[model samples]
Target: MLADALGQVPYFSAREVEALVAAWNKPITLRRGEYLVQHGQVERNLYFVKSGLLRIYYPTETEEICVGFAYAPNVVCSFPSFVHGTPSEYCIQALRQSELLGISKNDFAALLELLPNIARFWREELEKVLVGRIDREIDLLLAEPERRLERLLRRSPHIFQLVPKKYIASYLRMTPETLSRLR
Candidate 1:
């Protein structure tokens, strides 16, 4: 699973990949609806999803705002909090029974120092995620609800099948009725 996930990134050497696999061999499991990282807690680890799905969200005055979803073969963490060692403002929860490989922040930092190629790969991956977040922000600001839903479907058509409609509606910044109408 890790090999497949890293196949697209060409920077890692065989040795570096081996080291990464060893370091990330710590396995974790989460049942559906279990919180992996809760708001107000310091996020100490970065998780790689081997299987299943995760939802990232934060509580608002009236409701929880769904910020994103992480599917298998993807990385899921409260990134800002993990990087800065601050309490997370968001929460990460398992949307389905999940299998994950985790590396603590300190261990990840040490691994980066030990393997420059892996560090480069990590940087590029984070950059891509940052760019995607910026693009999504632009979409949310400029697109109509229907347009937003259309774009999401185009990008991740399977999300409707994998995630609940209410969460999808929250992620799209729309009401459940609006999402139903769109469907």
Candidate 2:
């Protein structure tokens, strides 16, 4: 199951992938509203989603803003915290009943040590995420809400059906009412 989840990245051989999967300490089950990692806490593990939804959000002085969303077969965590061992500035919360394969930082480092090819795959994944972030930022700056909504729909249709409108609006840097109006 884990192998299939990670199959999109071609650098991993079956044996190496299995070895990486085996490095995970355990599987964690989370219910709706449960936080896998709260803002300001050190991110200890990388969460490989087995099932369900996760919202990556952050709190402002007066509001909570949704930064992104992750579905099953996706990865959830504060990337900077995971990479730098700093406290996370983001929160990762399960949006529904969810199962995650939890790989600790130590184990992940060891896997990279043992199988260097895994490092290439990890880099590629991170690059993909970074590019997405950059694109989103550009869109937020240059596009109107309706244009943003259209672009989002083109890139990830059915996301509105899967994720709440408020969160989607927040991620797009628009008011929920504005998103609704645009729709």
Candidate 3:
């Protein structure tokens, strides 16, 4: 699974892949709805989802707003917090029972130092994530809620089956009733 995920990262050599495998520990499991990183806590490790799904969200005064999600075979972290060494403003939780492989931030940094290729791969991956965020932000700013939901479904139809309806509704910036009506 780790090798497959590494394949998604461009130009990762076999040795670099081996090094990453060595650095990441065995898979850890989280029960449904369990918090992986809570708001206001420092996220010390970056998780690679081996199975199941995780939601990244922030709590508003009225409710928890879903911001993003990590599906199987994808990396999940509170980016700003992880990069800056600060408490995360968002929480990461298991949307369902999940299996994850994790590498501590320190270990990841050491790996980057040891393998320059991995550093390049990391930069490219972060760039892609940034671009995706910008696109999502534009959608939020310009699209109607129903249009946003339609776009989301077009991009990730599997999300409807994998994630809870309420979270999906929040992620699309619509009420659950609105989501149901659209559906």
Best by lDDT: 3
Candidate 1 per-residue C-alpha lDDT over 1-183 given as tens digits, one digit per residue, 9 for 90 to 100: 886677656766678877777788779999999988998999999899999988999988899999999888888899889989999999899989999999888888998898888899888888989888887887699568998888788878888888999999999999999999989
Worst 10 residues of 2 by lDDT: 3-12
Per-residue alpha-carbon lDDT of candidate 3 for residues 1-183, written as tens digits (9 for 90 to 100): 988788666687789888998999857899998988889998889898999899999988889999999988888888889989899999999988999999999999999998999899888888988888887887798558888987788878888988889999999988999999999
CA lDDT for candidate 2: 0.84
lDDT computed for candidate 3? 0.88
Off by over 4 Å in 3: 8-10
Candidate 1 clashes: the total is 0
User: Per-residue lDDT of 1-183 in model 2, one digit per residue for the tens?
Assistant: 677876666666777778877886479999999988988999878888888998998988987888888887887778889889899999889888888888888988888788878888777888999898887887788657888888889888978888988899998889999998888
Q: What lDDT would each prediction earn against the true structure? A: 0.87, 0.84, 0.88
Instruction: Provide the clash count, candidate 3.
Output: 0
Best first by TM-score, ranked: 2, 1, 3
Q: In model 2, what lDDT does residue 48 have?
A: 86
- lDDT of candidate model 1 versus the reference: 0.87
- TM-score (all chains, Cα) for each model: 0.93, 0.93, 0.92
Output the worst ten-in-a-row residue range by lDDT, candidate 3: 4-13
